[model samples]
Target: MVDYATARMNMVESQLRTNKVTDQRVLEAFETIPRERFVPDHLRSLAYVDEDLRLKDDRYLVEPMVQARLMDVADIRAEDVVLVVGAGSGYACAILATIAATVVGLESDPELAKLAESALQEQGVDNAVVIQGEMNKGYPKQGPYDVILLNGAVAEVPKALTDQLSPKGGRLATVVRSDSGPGKGTVFERWEKAVGRRTLFDANTPVLPGFHKQPGFVF
Candidate 1:
């Protein structure tokens, strides 16, 4: 049988550390989380692979390096409340739960939300709460989060999501499309009265459905 623990450690060292994922806390969370448990039973064997794993329908699991990079960018804290948008299968949420005080995992797909809830519960992750809702609409009831992490790529960061930040208390990290070429990893942090958004790294990821631009109306 393949040693999953060893694979996880190797992934952290080879894929994450080499790619600039230097946050020790984030690396530790990645190494400890049982990634296979968050994936479908049939695809568990490919859990530690360097490629994105396709789940049911058009949704997909983000690559390990991509996820690790985003978490490092967020720089989660023990006292922070995090909101995980597009929380697929609770893998990212599980990672956030390890560092943050609380995690709100919002998913639009009912089945996926249920799967995430079950996965987190099975892992005894008590700091996360799973909720089903429209992917484009940010979860406001649990608002004032210390950090917001979008699990999928999008053309732009929604204002609704940004408005949920706790004053200058948090930041939002996501995969946003660049004006040219492929998408770029971006981070938005509240600064005084303004929100400063910047692209961190070039990335290629499947765009989340709800964040797509609407088609122009015919004349």
Candidate 2:
């Protein structure tokens, strides 16, 4: 059996810490969460590896580095109610639960959502609730969340999602693409009625489903 505990520690010390993820809470979450439980039985051995772990459908548990960096940039607070978009296997949601008061993990894949929910519950993560839904449409029923973290990249940040940010110090994070190419992880903060955004770092992450623009008519 793979030593997942050791692997998790190495991931935090090497992959995360070495890459600028300095937040103590974020580091501890990564260390504490058993990533092995979130992946399929066959993939469990590789769960702590640095790459993104593929799940059912075309979804992915965004790469470890990207996930860590996104959390580091969001700077989640103890009282924050967070919303996680495209929460693949609930790994990020579980991590967020450690730092935030509550987390709503949204996923379009029914099977994945069920699995994620079961895994979280099995691991005794009570602060997160994984639900099935379209990835682009933010979970409005739970909204006006303090922090919104997209598990994958996007061609553009949809207004529908940004509009769900809390009217206070709400913050959102996701990577944007340059015509389906590479992407840069960005953090957006709501300032009164307007939202201000800034790039945190570059991460070539997969774009979440439903966020892609419809194809234009070809000539």
Kindly list the per-residue Cα lDDT of model 2 for residues 63-154, writing each as its tens digit: 78999998999989999999999888888899999999999999988888998999999989998999898889889999999999999988
In angstroms, give how far residue 33 of model 1 lies from its true place: 0.6
Residue pairs with backbone atoms closer than 3 Å in model 2 (clashes): none
Clashing pairs counted in every model: 0, 0
Candidate 2 has its poorest 10 consecutive residues by lDDT at 173-182
Q: Deviation in angstroms for 132 in model 2?
A: 1.1
Estimate, for each residue in 122-160, the C-alpha lDDT of model 1 and write its tens digit. 999998989999878889999888899999898888888
Cα-based TM-score, every candidate: 0.96, 0.96
List per-prediction Cα lDDT, in the order shown. 0.89, 0.89
Candidate 2's C-alpha runs over 4 A off are 217-219
